[model samples]
Target: SVSSRSRISLIASTVTIAGAGALLAPAQSKK
Candidate 1:
């Protein structure tokens, strides 16, 4: 159960960071 929860949170955090990276990418590229 602990492993499963850790995996889920890891995936969730990865997705959140990926989304934030996507959102920020264009701004960075524009500079």
Candidate 2:
């Protein structure tokens, strides 16, 4: 279903953004 696929993509995007934020925090602290 399209709705299910959209939900999955949304979750994937949120996870990617969260992961990127986590990775960026360490670099920001070093500066």
Candidate 3:
């Protein structure tokens, strides 16, 4: 159970970072 929970958290963080990067990439490119 613990391992599964940690894996889920890791995936969630990766997704959050990816989403943030996706949102910021276009703004940076426009500059």
TM-score of each: 0.86, 0.91, 0.92
Q: State in Å the error of residue 7, model 2.
A: 0.2
Q: How big is the positional error of residue 18 in model 2, measured in Å on the Cα after superposition?
A: 0.2
* Per-candidate count of clashing residue pairs (backbone under 3 Å): 0, 0, 0
Off by over 4 Å in 2: none
- Candidate 2 Cα RMSD after full superposition onto the native fold (Å): 0.4
- Compared with the true structure, what per-residue lDDT tens digits does model 3 show for residues 1-31? 9999999999999999999999999999999
Which residue runs of candidate 3 sit more than 4 Å off their true CA positions? none
For model 1, the local distance difference test gives 1.00
**lDDT for position 8 in model 1:** 100
Segments of candidate 1 deviating more than 4 angstroms: none
Clashing pairs in 2: none
Q: Candidate 3 has which clashing residue pairs, if any?
A: none
All predictions: root-mean-square deviation over Cα?
A: 0.6, 0.4, 0.4
lDDT of 1 by residue, 1-31 (tens): 9999999999999999999999999999999
